[model samples]
Target: MHNYFILLISLFLLSVSCNSDYTPKPRGYFRIDLPEREYKQTPEKLPYAFEYPVYSVLVNYRQTQPELYWINLVFPKFNATLHLSYKTIDNNLEEYLNDSRNFVYKHTVKADAISETPYLNAEKKVYGILYDIKGDAASNTQFFLTDSTHNFIRGALYFEVYPNKDSLAPVLDFINKDLVHLIETFEWN
Candidate 1:
């Protein structure tokens, strides 16, 4: 009876030790499906024009900004918007340029790094600066194109969702390519 009692206690101890606590798996995000790159140019009569992705939609921005030519590129799947503001340079090029730079700098507190790439197409008379902001900034890309005389247009890509870099990185890259295509084909009317 002593041996039986010892065996029973040992078995109970072994069974209790073998039972482990339940641990749930870490959280995960849904897989994003990216579409092929296709684009079409804006319609005639606009002061400026650029090719945008077919997957996106162009909507007139009804913001409080005084500019009447403001527009947005809406990416429904990603819940992102590319806001474009147009201004006819009336000797205010310098001020507008500074404002554009300042807007990018506002993200400095959250950005890990900010890099600017200057673009100039002498033949097309298009010149601009492209800013790539890394980290958890509200906007990841911003740019401005100007003829340095008559037309100045600024654009920034922002997401409706929270600024999570890892979750948004792939979408950012995809839109970055579209933005590049737009700039390459941009023309001032």
Candidate 2:
């Protein structure tokens, strides 16, 4: 009789607990720690020069036939790199501009939206367009700076990880500020 009563109580308790509504919590991501903003100027030998974040390491882009001016600003912490390719204008400014436009638009298929912001620093003779790509694209930011006569530089920011805008928003925001600073301080050398 005692065993039967205990069993009845256990079943009643189980039934009562199951009656409460339960909702599963959404997924969560790990916290990201961003570094403080600090910049160092590029070496003078390059055709162009700009200030890049101190946390990033400047390395030459490795290719079978790499140009002297093609380099990458690698952010090890974020596993991201900003590729900068320099081209010497030889009456081909229009071609370079078109190439840059095409590169940005290529992300349209995966990009939620793409916005272009023209950057002009007449005193520095720096004119370019900054492409801000929104969504799960391979590249989130791209820009091209040109002197319209002798120098043209195209830059694209890419991450090694899978592209998920939601998880990458904070890092993207942080890097965007550095990019702006780099563009603002850019000068032909």
Candidate 3:
């Protein structure tokens, strides 16, 4: 009766295994390590000067029609870049403001929400709006600063990798603090 016993045991094991529930585990991402915060001032020659993270590398933006004041602040560790474009506001402040707003809204199809945080420093004469775009939009952060008389600057933060809010939340938060610090220290030259 050895064969009979073997069959019974196999059947019992199969039934026990079938009765156990199986659940799929959620996907996971690798942990990200951020660097310590330290900043240095932008070069005095730039039309605008601000303190940026020491971890970032400042490079001139390459374009077919590159403007003198256009530059990029790149974070090599995170594969992200902050593009800064400057324009002289020759009574065209309204136009520049509209363009910045339109650029932020273009990502609404992918953004869950867009929040605007007003930044004003009367003593420094630096005023701007920081746009925090939520979700899988191309750019997670955008901002525009103006002296309201002569200078206007726009900046957008973009990552080289695909945008996944859940995966990139930690890095984004860390960089956001750096951006805020830069804004606070911004000055027109």
Predictions in order: lDDT: 0.93, 0.95, 0.95
Candidate 2, 10-44: lDDT as tens digits: 99999988886788998788899999999999988
lDDT score of residue 162 within candidate 2: 100
How are the candidates ranked when ordered by TM-score, highest leading? 3, 2, 1
Estimated TM-score per prediction? 0.87, 0.89, 0.91
Better of 1 and 3 by TM-score: 3
Candidate 3 per-residue lDDT over residues 19-94, each given as its tens digit: 8678999989899889999999999888899999999999976564267789999999999999999999888899
Error of 1 at 135 (Å): 1.3
Error of 3 at 36 (Å): 0.5
Off by over 4 Å in 2: 1-17, 20-22, 62-65
Candidate 3 weakest lDDT stretch, 10 residues: 60-69
Candidate 1 regions with alpha-carbon error over 4 angstroms: 1-26, 62-65
Of the candidates numbered 2 and 3, which has the greater TM-score value? 3
